[model samples]
Target: MLNSLLRISQKTALTLVFGLFSGLASAQATTYYFSNSGNDSNKGTSISAPKKSLAAATALAKAGNKLLFKRGDAWYIPFGLFDLSNKSGTRNNPVIIDAYGAGDKPVISNLNVLSDDGWENIIGTTTWKHAIYGYSKALRLFANGVSKYKVNTSDKLANETDVDQPHEWFIKEGVINKNGIVYMNTGSSLVAPKNVEVLMVGSKPVVLMENTNYFTFRNIDFRGGSTSNIVNIWAPSANITFDSCIIQQGAGSGIQAGHSGQGDLTTYVANINILNCLVDKVWSDYENDPNILLSGDGIFMLHAVEGGLVQGNKILNWGHSGISITSYILGVHGVHNLIVEMNDVSGGESAYTHAIDMNGFEGLTTHNIIRRNYFHDYTVTGHILGSYNQIYSNIFAGVTVTKMPRHSHQGWGVDWAVWRYRGTGPWIEAHHNYLVNNTFVSTEECAIMIQDSKANPIAVSNNVIANNIIYNFGDIAIDVNTNVAGTVIVQHNNFWQENSTEPVARFKNLGTKDVYNAAELNLVLPQYFRGNTQFNPRFTDVAKRNFTLTESSPTALKYGGTTQYTSLLGEDFVDYFGKKWDPFKPSMGAIQYNGGD
Candidate 1:
C-alpha cells in the first residue's frame, strides 16, 4: 500500500512540471501574419486570417513573437510613423518583423503627398520654399523618381554657414511666413513648378524605434520620406538590427542610431548590427547645415556604443559621406569596440564629402576596426581615422571613367589616409592608430597623404603603419602637408608607380626638396621614419590583374621578428602569410606571397 501511494505522487508531480514548461513556451512565442486583404478584427493567429495594418498588428506584438508582412504588398503608414514604445526582447529571442509568401519584398512608406497648390509662383529664382512637410530634419526634391538639381547660392542665407553650396531644397520657418518655406533653385532665373511630380517628407520618420530593445527587421523595402531617414532610433536601444532590406529615398539621411547628450558614456546605445542591407540615395536637396555640419549620410551611428557590428551592406549615392561613425558630444565623448567590415560604399563623390568620415571632433573614438571593404569613385578622402582607430585589409580604388575633374596637379586627387586630428589625446598630439596591410589602386594622387590641415600642426606620434601596397599614385608616394612635429612609425611598405616619373615622398610642403626635412615639415624626420621600403612589391602579373607577389619579389621574402610591429594594435595577428606563418619571417603587404585572402 505505501509503495503504490509513493509511485502515484511521483507521477503527478512530473505531470505538473511538464505542464508548466509547456505553457510558458507556448505563451512566450507566436507567429502573426499581415495582409492588406485581411481585417484588423481577426485574431491574426494564422496566415488565412491575418491583420491588415502593421500598426495594429505591432500593437499586439510581444517578445519572441514573429510578425510577417505579406510579400508583394505596400503599406503607407500615416505621417510616416511606425512608433514602438516600451518593449524589450532578449538576444536569444528577438521580436522579428519580416516578409512572408516570397515574391517582391513588402514595402512600407509615407502616404502623404505634396499638393501643387501649396507651391506658389516665385519671382527671383534664387530661393524657393514650401512648408508642406514638417519643417525639421532635411528634405529632398525629386522628379519622376530621379534627383533633380537645386540652385546654388553664396549668401549668409538661412541657418547654415556652409551656405553658397548647392542644395536641392532649403526649408526654413519664417522665411516667407510662420508656415516655413521650401527653397528650390531649379537653376532658372525665373523658376516655376513644371509638369514634374513632387513629393515631400514631413517631420516624422517612416519607422521610428523609441525606448525599445532587441527588434529585428528583415526582408523589407522601406521607401519615401520628406523628413529624415526611413528609420530612426531615438533611444539607447540594444540589439536593434536591420538585415536584407532596401532603404531608399532618404530626405536627410539613411539611418541614425544614437544621439549625444551630457557627454555621458554610461547611457550609451549598444549592440546594434546593420547587416546585408541595401541603403541607397541618402541625398538631401535641402538641409539645415547650420555651421556647415550635419548633412545626408547613408548610415550614421553616434555616441559611445559598445559591441556593435556593421557588415555586408551596399551603400551608394549618398549626398554626403557614406558611413559616418561620428558623435556630437557637447563635451568629451567616446565610442569603442566595434567592427565595420565587408561593405561596398561607392558613388558618393560630392565635392564636399568623403566615403567614410569618423568625426571625433566631440571626443575620443577608439578601438574601432574597419576592414575588408571596397571603396570606389569617392573623389575626396576615401577614409579618415581618429586616434585609437585601426584601418586594415581593405581596397581603395578609383576608376578612370568615374574620375572627376579634381585630379589636376596640386589638387585633392591623392585623397588621404590616416588623417589625424588634435583636440587632446595620450600619444603625443595625435596617436594610437594603425594603418596596416591595405591595397590602394588610386589613379589620381599618391598612395598615402598625411594632412594636418592647419598651419604648423602639432605632434602625431606613436602611430604605426606597416606592410601596405600603394599603386598608381600620380605624383609622389607619401605627401605630408603641414609640419608634423611628433613621431610617426612607418615600416616595410610597397609604393608602386603610377605616373612613372613621380618621386617617392614629398615632404617640406612648398617647392619640395628631395630630402625628408624634419623642422620644415614639422616632423621629427628619420626618427619618425622606421624601416619603410619604397620598392615594387612585384606582383605575379600586373596585366593579368594578379596582385599577389611573385616568389622573386623582394617583399615576398622574410621579415625578422625585430621588424615586427607588435606594439601597434596590441595583437600579433597574421597578415599576408596567415596566422600559422613563422613569426620571424612575415611577408609584406595584405596579399601573401601564397595569394591567400
Candidate 2:
C-alpha cells in the first residue's frame, strides 16, 4: 500500500514538472527587432539592440515569434530570405512580420540606386548614357520613383513618346565581361543619374515561401522584383496572410501563390488571405507580346489552391488581368472557394487583358465567389470559363477597350462587363454561373455577353442573370448569340438608357433578335421574362458614379420584389455601401434603396 501511494505521488510530480516546462517553452517565443543601424552581433530581443539585416533576424526566428522592422528604414534584399521555408506556427500564435515604429512601412526591395556622376552626355543629342551591368536584356528602371518607358531599340527612341512627351529609354547590349549602356532621353532635359534606380531581371522574387504555414505579414512595402512574382507562396503552403502591404513594380505579378506543378489534392495551397492591400504597376515582358496570352498581373493564383480570401484590396495599373485564378496542367483540380470581394480594380493596360481572368484549365475552377467589387477604366471585367461561380453586387464602370496599333491585324474589338465565352479545352463548358444584383454604368460596350464562336463544341448553359441594373451602356444591354439562346435565363432586371424620350431597354441579340419592348421580351421568353422594367433608375449622381436610387423611382420600390433565383445568390445580402437588405425583397441594383416611396 505504501509503494502504490509513492508511485501516484511520483506521477503527479512528473505531470506538474512537464506542465511547467511547457509553459516556459510557450513564454520563450521571442520578438526579434530589425533596424538599419543595428549590428548582427547584438541581441535582437530589444529595439535598442536590434539585428541589422533580414538575414540575421531570419536565422534566429522560430515558430510563434514576431519579426519587427523599423518603420522608416529600408533594406535591399537581393537574395530572398529562403530560411522561412518549412516553418509552421500554431493557430493561436502566428509568425508575424510587422513594423515596430512610426513614419512609413519598412521597404524591402531589389532596386539599386545609381550614383549621380555615372551619367555621360551623348554629344549632339538630347540623351545621356549610363553603364549598369553586363548586357542583360531585362532591366526594370524607375526614374523619380516612376516606372519609365522602355523602347524596343535605340533607333525607336524618337518615336516612343509617352502621352505627348518625349520621355523614353533604350538599352544597348555589351560584350562579354563588359557593362551594358542605358540610353535615356527626357525631351531635351538633362538626365539625373541619381534619380534613377534599376532592378536587374533574373527571376528573383523578394519573398519565396515553400511549405510555410500560418504566417502573417502586415504593413510592409514589397517592391521592385525581377521575377514572376514579388511574393511567392509555393505549393502546400497554407494559412498565409498579407494585410495592408504595398506590393508594386514587379516584372510579372504582385503575389503569386500555389504550385502549377502539383497534382495531388493534399499538395495544394490553401487558406491564403490577402486583405486591405495595394498592388500597383506590375508589368511583364509578355504584356505587349501579342503571341503570348498571359500578361503581368496584379494577383496570380496557380493551380491547386482552395479556400482563400482576397478582400478590400486596390489593384491598379496591371498589365494584364487584375486577378487571375489559373491552372495550366491537365488532371489537376483548379482554384476554388476564393472569396474575392470589395476590391477596386483598374487594369487591361496591355494587350487583350481582362479585369479578372478565370479562363485557365477547363472544368477545374469551381465554386468561386466574386462579390461587391468596383471595376473601372478597364477593358473587360471578367473573361470566365469557370463553372458554379457567383458574381454579384459589383459595379462595372468605364469599361473601354484600347485599340493596340501594333496588334491591328487582331482587331481588338470591344467586350462586355462579364463575358462567359467558350473554353479553350474540350469537355469544358461555361455553365451554372450566377450574376445577381449588379450595376453596370457608363460602359463603352454592352453590359453582359454570353456568346461564342460556332466552331466550339462545348455549349454555355444554365447561367442566371437576374436582379441587375443595366444603365447607360453604349451598346446593347444584354447580347446573347443564337447558339446559346435557350441556355441563359435573363429576368427580373431594370434596364434604362440615358437621355431618350422613349427609354427602349436595348436588350438585344437573343439569337439575332432584339427585344426593345417589355412585351417583346415576354413574348420571346414568356416564362422567364417577367418583371423586367425599362425606366429611368433616378440616380443621385451619375457623374460621381453613385447609383443610389431616389425616393420616387419605381424600380426601387415597386418593380424589385421577390426573386425566383433566391438560392443562387450567396448568403451575404449586404449592398455596396455595407447596408444589409432582406434577401426575399431585394432591391434592383447593388444599392438597396431604404427610403420610402
Candidate 3:
C-alpha cells in the first residue's frame, strides 16, 4: 500500500513544523518603566530593575507589553482608579501607554490620588456648610472608593438656593457638595471643593475600562481633576486607541464611552480611535442649583457605540457640546460606523450649544463623516441635531447660535419651541453630506436648520449646500421646515448673504405639505429651490467679515441644475472657502468659487 502511505505523510510534516516555530517564539516584545523613582520590588527587567507604578506596570502587562513613563516623571499615584479590566493588545503588540523623553517632557500629576485626610467632617461643618443640602435627594459621587456622582431628585437642597429653583428638580442622591457654589436651576457646574479633593480621595475613575480589549494610550497628561471621565471606556471595549493625549480639567468629561446606565445586553464600547488628543477645561461635577454653572461636555459617546474614529483632536474650553455622540434613553440603541475627522473644535462657552452634537443615534449617524475640520468659536457649527448626522468638509469661523431660554423667563418663541422638540429620535439618513466649501464669518442664527417632524422621516437627500459664504446677523440662509410627511431636498446651494438684507431661503408649513415618491406612489410638492446666479456673493470684505466671492461675483459660474454630488473631486468644484470650481465648466453653485481655470 505504497509503503503504508509513506508513513502517514511523515507524521503530518513533523506536526506542521513544530507549530510554526512555537508561534514565532511566543511573540516576544515587552518593555516596562515608570520610575516615579522605581522599586515596586524591582525586576521589571529593563536591565533587571524597573517598575514604579502605572499601577505597578499595569499589573505586569501582557499582550506584547510596553508601558514606558519616565521623562520628567511626577507619577504621584494615590487617589486611585486605573482599572483596565482583563487587558489585551494586538495589531502587532499594541498595549502602549507612552511618554518618555522628548519635548512636552513628562507631568502626569495627582493621577487622581488626593487624600490630605480631611472630609471626616462626616456631614458636619455646620451641616455641610450650605454648598448643597439635598432635597429631591439622590446624589452619588466617588473616586478611589468609586462611584463618580449620580444625582436623581424629586426635590433637593443644601443651599445653592434650594437647588436653584424654577422647578425641575428630580434629584435622587449622589452629592459630593464641592462648593464653588454656582448651581442655579441645576443642569451642571459647582465643582471646586478644591476639585473635590481628587474625587474625595479616590472615589473612582481616572481611566477605567470595563470589558477590555486591545488598548493603547499615548503621550499622557491628564491634569487637575473632578472625574466622571478623563477616559472612561466602559462596556466590552474593542480595539481602542488614544494617541497624543492631554485631556485637561475634568469635572465630568474628556473622553467617555458607553452605558449611561439602565441596561440590557450591555453593548460594549466599539472600535474606538481618538487621535492627536488635547481636550481642555471640561466641567459638570454636579450642584444642581447654587445659581447654575452646570454644563460640561467634551467627547462623550454613550449607548451602543460601534466603529468610532474621532481624529486629530484639539477641543477647547468647553462646558457642553463640543462633541456629544448620544443614544439617550428609550430601549437604548446606536449603530452605523461613525467618523469625525481632522478636528480642531473651539471655545464653546455653552449657553445652548454645539460644535458637533449628534443625538439619539440611529443607523449610526448614517454614513458618518465630518471631514477636514477647523470650526471656530462654536455655539453651533455642525449639529445635525440628531437624525442621520452626516456633515462634511468643515471650516466655519466664529460660529454662533444664541436663542437661549430653556427656562430663564423663556421666550425666543419658547426657545424656538425647545429647539424644535429636540427631535424625538430615529429618522437618520441625511445623505451625501458635504456642507460644501465652507466659510462663515460671523453667524448669530440660522446657518443650517432642516426641519422634518411627523415622527422623523430623515432623508435629506444629495446634500451639497455648495460654496457657503455667509455672515448673517439674525438668521435665514437655508431653513427648511417640513412639518409632517417629510422630505427635505434643497438643491445645488450657494447662498452669500453677508448681511445682504437677510432672507435667502425660508419655507413655512405648520402642516399639509406633501411629498411621496415611494418609488412612484406620486404626490410631490415639498421641494424648495433657489438655484445658481441670484447675485450678491460679493464680499472681499463685508466690513471685516470677509466672505470671499468677488470676481464679478453673481456667485461666479452661476449654478444650473443636475444635482448629484457625493463630493465629486475631478470636476474641481470645491467651495467651502478652499476655492476651486469649474473642472471643464460645471460650476453653478455649492463651491468652486473660481480656482478652476
Candidate 4:
C-alpha cells in the first residue's frame, strides 16, 4: 500500500512538469512590454512591469501576440531587428506590436548609435565634411596623404594606404601628437581609424515579408536610421494592408515591393492597400556618398499582379521619385486597376526628380485615376511618364520646372509624356480633367506641357481644358508637341493672367486647332470667355494680400458655363497665414478671393 501511494505521487509531479512545458511551447498569444529601466524577465506586460528590450519580447511572441510598449518611454536600440519572417497570422488575428498605456500614444524615439568620431569619419571620406564643396575635399585629401591620391569628377579623393590598393580616409582631428596617439584636439594627422561610421548596411529591408500573406500593420511609427528600406513586401506578401502608419526617415524607400534580380519570380505583390499613412523624409545614404547612385522611390510598386489603391496619404520629402510603378525586365506583365487618388505630394526634388512617376512597358496602367490632389512647392516636376492615365482635379502651386544655373539643370522641367522609351504607341485620352479652377502660381515654365514625340500611333482626343486660372506663369499654359496621328482637342480653357510673352497654345502641324487657333485657321476657339472676369481678383484686406474672392465680386455668378465645373475658384482655399476663404460662385481663377469686411 505504501509503495503504490509513492508511485502515484511521483506520477502526479511528472504530469505537472509536462503541463508547464506544454504551456511554454504553445504560447500562441501573449502581451509583452518594454522599458529602459526594466529587466528581461520583468513580466513584460505593462509600463510598471516591462521588458528590457523589444528583441526580448519579439523572440517569445507568437502569431497572435501583442508586444505593447510603454508610453513616453524612450528606448535606445542601436541595431535592433524585429523579424516577423516565420510568423504567420490571419488578418483578424495579427501580431500587434504597438505603444501602450497613457492613452496608447507611444513615442518610440529613434536611437542615434554613431559617435562623433564615426560621424567625422563619414563626413571626411564622403567630402560632406563642410557645407561648401572643393575646400572640404582638398582638406580631406591633404589629411589622407595627397601624394597617393586621385580626385574624381565630383571632387572626392581616393588613395592607397601601404600599397597601391585604393583606400580613403577623413580627418578626425586637425592635429597629431608625435607619439602616434589620437586625441580630440586640433591638427590631428593622417591615419585610417579602426572605427568607421555606422553606415546603414543591409539591403535585406527592415521589415521583410517573404512567402507571407494576410498581414496588416496599423498605427505604427517606423522611424529611420539604417540603410535598409522601411518595409520590403516581396512577391510572397499578397493581400496586405498598411494603414494609418508613419513610415519616415528611412535610408532607402518607405515601402518597396518586388525584387530587383531575375529569378523564378514566384512571389508577386498584389491586393495591397496603403491608406491614410504618412510616408515622408525617405532619403538615401548615397546622397552623401558620391560613389553610389540613389535608385529606389518612396512607394515602389513593381510588377504587381493586381494593382492596388494608394489613397489619403501624404508622401513627401523623398530622395528619389515619390511613387513608381513598372514591369519586370523578364517581360512579366501585371495589371488590373491601379487607383492613386487624394494624395498630397510635395518636396520630391533632392537631385532634381519627380513627385509621382510611373513607367509601364507593354503592361497597362489603364483605368488609373489620379485626381483631386494638391501637389505644390516641389523643386522638380510634379508628375511624369505615364500612359492611359486620367490626371484631373489637381491643384499645382509653386511648381518650378526650369533648371536655374545655380539650382539645377534647365532642361529638366515637367513634360507630360506617354513614355521615356520612345516606343511607338497610341496616345491615351487626357479628357474632362478639370484642369480648370486650379491654381498654377509662380511656375517657371509651361503649366501643362505635353510631348508625344515617340512615333507611337496613340491619339490625344476628347480632352477638355476650360476655365483654369493661371497667374504669374513663365511660359505658355498649354504646349502640345506630339507626332500623334489622331485629332487632339483643346477648348474652353481660361488662360488668366499669364506672364509669358509667347502664345498661350502652341501646336505643331495639327489641323483641328480651335479657339485662338480657329481665327488663324478660320474657325472659332470653341469656348466662351464671357462673364468669366479676371483682375487682381479682389483679395480681401489689402494688407494681408489675400486672394479669396468676396461674394459681391464680379466672379460670383459671372462664371457662365453649362457643364458643371469640378472646382470652385477657392474650394477650401487658405491663405499663407492659415486663414480660410471661399468664393461666391465658381470663381474663374485657382484662388477665390473673399471680399473684405
Leading candidate by lDDT: 2
Per-candidate TM-scores read: 0.72, 0.85, 0.33, 0.65
What lDDT tens digits, residue by residue, belong to model 4 across residues 128-197?
2211111111211212111112223144342212112233322222222111111121222343323222
Residue 158, model 4: lDDT of 26
- Candidate 2 colliding pairs: none
Alpha-carbon RMSD of each model: 12.2, 10.6, 21.1, 14.7
**Mind giving the per-residue lDDT tens digits that candidate 2 earns over 102-176?**
999998887665666887866656667778664345456776666666665233443312212334666666764
Ordering by TM-score? 2, 1, 4, 3
* Residue 99, model 1: Cα distance from true site in angstroms: 1.0
lDDT of each: 0.58, 0.67, 0.50, 0.47
Indicate whether candidate 1 or candidate 2 has the larger lDDT.
2
Residue 175 error, candidate 1, Å: 16
Could you give me the TM-score of model 1 versus the true structure?
0.72
Residue 580 alpha-carbon offset, candidate 1, angstroms: 7.2
Q: Give me the overall lDDT of model 3.
A: 0.50
lDDT per residue, candidate 3, 1-597, as tens digits?
211211121111001011111122125567777666778888665634667877776785556777877666656443455677767665556577777666664545444333323222212111111132312222223232222322222232434334333221222223453322222232223321222313233334567787677668788876543446666777666777787788765655677877656456446577677877878753332323334443556787776677667876878666566677766544544634567665777754444445666645334444445554666666544555443444543555566543443313210100111132345544443444445445455565656656454544444444445434444424455555655234344444444444333345554652433221111111223243333223455555656544444566663433332335534532323333334444444344333444323
Report the C-alpha lDDT of model 1 over 1-597, residue by residue, as the tens digit.
Answer: 211111111110000011111112325578888998889998887989999997785685567789899999878653546776566665556789999997989988763344545556455444344554343333345543455433322233544222233345454544332245555544454554442323343546777775678778999988765445767775456677899898876666787777546444456556677888888874433432322433467887766555577777888777566787765453433566677766777755343445676645423566777765665566556444556777765666663322333331222322323333343432212356777776666546656666553432434545666667777666666676655444556665666674323356665644446544212222334555545545566666655434556766764333421235545544524342223234456556555455332
Assess the local accuracy of residue 164 in candidate 4 as a C-alpha lDDT between 0 and 100.
24
